[model samples]
Target chain A: MTRASRLYRSSLLVAFAALALTAGCGKKQAAPPPPPPPPPPPPAKPTVTLQAAPTTIEKGGSVTLSWSSTNATALVIQPAIGNVAPEGSTKVSPDATTTYTITATGPGGSIDATASVNVTQPPPPPPPPPQPTLEELFARDVHDAYFDFNKADIREDAKAALSKDADFIKAHAGIKVVIEGHCDERGSTEYNMALGDRRAAAVKKYLSSLGVPADSLTTVSYGKEKPSCTESTEDCWQKNRRGHPVLAK
Target chain B: MIRQPRTPRIALKLHWFFAALLLAASPALAQDWFRTGTGLGVERPRVAVADLVPRAPEATAHGKLFTEVVRGDLDFSGILELVSPSFHPLQSPGMPLQLNYKAWSDAPASAQMVAFGNLQESSSEAAIEAWLYDVRNPSSPPVVAKVYRGAPTDAQIRKFAHQFADEIIGKLSGGLPGVASTQIAFISNRTGSKELWVMDYDGANQHALTALRTISLMPRWSPDTSRIAFACYIQAFGILSPQICMFSLELGRPVTFPRFHGSNSAPAWSPDGSQLMFSSSMSGYPEIYSIDANGSHFKRLTFSAGDSASTSPAWNPKTGQSAAFISDRGGFPQLYLMNSDGTNIRKMDLPDMGYVIDPAWSPNGQLLAFSWRRPNGNFDIYVMDVTSHQIAEITRDAGRNERPSWAPDGRHIVFESTRGGSRQIWVMLADGSHAHALTQSGANESPNWSPR
Candidate 1:
């Protein structure tokens, strides 16, 4: 036979072989029929509802949770931190003042209400002033700074940290601060280092504005290095990408 | 009695005739025979001359040898733009021979070349003649300057073509040809394994230089064409650790650098080939570090908090006192230049284009070629005049054209692109013309041009 005819025959044979193989395998079973629908019956009734609970309650005090209901079945009370009340009941025990959520359910519908119990601790005697740890005091002279993503300007978070360092330096007139800038693991190393420096410098500028001596603070940038937290989470990254004050001896 | 004598004579004559036929068959039958068709046809008688004349060879342009020899010449010399036979319209099939002087004059091409050849019967052997034309002088007839004769195997054709093109370029440019005869070292993951591969500048004659088992990347060429350094990952204790390795073209063996904790990658060689600059997180962050060629004397160049300082260093050849690096010092990764001592740092004023990295210095130190992330998030190669600070985009529409390396002559740049659905090495004039894919299979990236 000619080459073309042979090829055509071979293809036909292959098709047949494939068909045979498929045929030898059984077909998939059909899905089961869906279940029948249920019949309709009961009528609904109007119900009163509590939108919210008391804004605050005294600490270590028991509070009663209540909600309006409709056609009756039961109500459920869930305390945020403690055990729920009796099945469908609204009373909860108290340890710490916490939020309690009350859900009232009947044949008609369900509704939720929440109440916050304020927990107050008894005033304690005033303690002695905090003595700065050696590391903290050492780092105090170093101006630490953090930056927002792709930014060198000091954010509120960075300012808070810098303010504390500034206060410590003002109290200890003899101490000098070195501002170290840091970055997250989002950019190349070189870019991050410059960014870190910018952060540190921004911190130093902020402190100097607050009457801190400019000559008392120095700035350096360690870009994306020495992360406070190594976990690849936003919270960790935020903490790591911050400037810190290290007291230069 | 007379009839019996006649019969005997006739029988004797018949026997003599048969003997003569057998002798003639013996001379012609000394040949190998094989069936040509299915058993449906009768066998035809034939003679075989197995030992007659030498075997006709398989034809090739001798691409490798051609590229090697041509690249050697260009390296030693300093010419750019090897005029290839394929580029000559007169030599191309179905192309008209009309010479356009204006077009040639406008082109950046330094020379024009022509080659013609015929393949032998076995299709392995070829006889080719080449001609070179000085585009600077369109009035002159083409010069029959050189003749290349060889029966190179099929694999050698591409090298031969490049070599011939380089020769023509040298004659026209008055220096050693640059990219035309050079090869690019790159990483290709076509075989499901990332390995270092070398190909001609135009992306032809691609072959794997490293073994298939390792995941190799960031291939950089030594000033000489003899070796390539790349980053490879080794699996140890259930973790894959990246390490730098050098592969010698001459030995076909890999010499891995010393092991270090964390990732070590982005290797660039000093102009003198004495040290290798790379980014390693060994000091707790990815910082620019240099090590001797034999992988000793590792020294950190930058110390910044957040451990972000320097990466992707392109050492300056002329001064050797400054290097261009990419840093996030501005909160976003941007290109920066710093003294070799990691001081005197300054940001490059790139155009409105942001996110520039991967700086490759031209051999002449007149320009810097780098890849920039475009607004569309696709990377494209761009060149900046060092003195004028003028920037121009070299490639567009080609998807992710990045990791550009300037050819030794500075007239051409080699880079990797994902334009053809798969990443492949591409070469174009430094001004972004004549873009073509050079690799056929596998995704290729991180192309580094050899110096010569």
Candidate 2:
């Protein structure tokens, strides 16, 4: 915009210089002192350029601020960087967004150029998701299938539990587990040992049919040796007579 | 053994019995004894065993032990009733010459047969003279007369008594060999370790055979009673592995058997003692496997589809053609019959839904005794007739009677029970009569009768 205005003014000045020469020959009306002849082009306007290599940066990051000027006798930048050479670059690290303006001054006038460096705090790294432990996963995803007294047959509730168990097992292809068959204290130690196995095996067969890898399962019978509940009530026994799945090392 | 009276010339009878002297070992009359043992006899005769006579003051202790042991043996013999000592005549015969038969057969004594014995113990050796006679026909002949001589140790005295008692039982039972001298191999933790132990059939003189300080279970004596095959928790190749372990009675040490992979346990010796059958998880599931007695030839005896746990294989003592074991291939564990070579597997389905485990074949192979946890009840010992598949629960309402192993006679069973407030070893007649504890302390379990 300044260059256009300067060019138009220079053209008018040329026409005036011609009129002054004509007036000098005629001596008509007290002629104003003719202005000095306009140079071929306006004094080369001072041009200032300021640039930041990386317009945006992290809070702890830095950017290169480069600047140059033409036909300037002096140059200076705002925002902490003061006087600088006509053409130079400097690395600036700012904790906040900042715009640097470099002013170039010369015979014609002063020109200002600006470059912005935007600094952001980078969305606090997504709080590391609370990853669930394998044990917790087992507790949540794998369920125990309960049985009736002296029974290894899968009941309706047991099917539902095992259905979820199969999904969990299948979802985690790398997981290996021991399906423990537990028996109530009502059975004999040795007999329950086998009975527990029956329960574990029943669950395993069901899971296998549901697409669980057979090799990933190991069955063990705790029998009446390891009871979840020790009370003589039926509720405790029911808790014991269950097929439980656990993560294996 | 004396079949005829030989003391008439030595001393004539005038209320005094004639003398008999015979020191010979008699062959077992198995047919006669097997009849009584089978419980088919019409009547059990009342027999009286007179208190042993100590010929010398130094022999009195041994005499008492011998007398009491014989009386106890007769009490448990099943074929006869023992007359209480209180009903015994005050003056027992020291020798045949001192016997008054009428006294033995009279009111207070009232014994159809009389057994008399005398012991003479020296510092170095002990000797015994024992005789059995039909008090009703005392003048005819002596039924049994024998002599025993051995070192004067207490062990020797007990041995002599056992020999005398076994002789009386064998002769009186018609021909069934007595188990008095037979030893029972069991697992005992009296020494603070689950070790293999051996005791007399009547529960005396128990001593540890293995001090491995590890768990040993389900001990079964070899057919020859020389080696005990058992399940042992031991380290093999630096890994804690459950493996079949063997303890040699003759060698008096734990003999090395081949070590297989995974949890190998519950060992059963084949009837011939040539091979041993055990449960092994080496194939990723518990299955029956057979290895030579010397640990050379290894063979898999069971193949359950898709990781079924099949274990506890018992070969028939009489027919060696088949074996009885427990398998869960049918959803729950049930008795299964398979050929000795692992062929012809058949499930022994019962009339009820339950868990059947610890399948043990009777000595005659006609029956399989196991623990079945019925749907309506807890674990109880059950005996199934192999031919008829008729099942009878021998143990009921007893705190979890399990692991029933038939005695060598096939008329009695030994099992583990929790009825006594703790796990203990118990024995009963095959019909579940006269149940008594053989072990009372330290959590005994998994009692397998020796195959005498």
lDDT of 1 by residue, A60-176 (tens): 455555555665465555655333322323444456666666665667676666666666665665888799786665554544455667677778876777787778788878676
User: How many residue pairs of model 2 clash at the backbone?
Assistant: 5
Give stretches of model 2 more than 4 Å off: A1-249, B1-33, B36-42, B191-193, B236-239
- Cα lDDT tens digits for candidate 2, A43-161: 77799899998999999899999998899989999889899999999999988999999999987789999999999987788789899987898898888999998678899999999
- What DockQ does each listed candidate score? 0.05, 0.08
- For every model shown, the clashing-pair count is 68, 5
Best by DockQ: 2
Candidate models: Cα lDDT each: 0.60, 0.78
Worst 10 residues of 1 chain A by lDDT: A31-40
lDDT of 1 by residue, B205-285 (tens): 778877747667778887766778877766432234456778888888887678675456778788788888887655444
Distance from true location, Cα of B126 in model 2, Å: 2.7
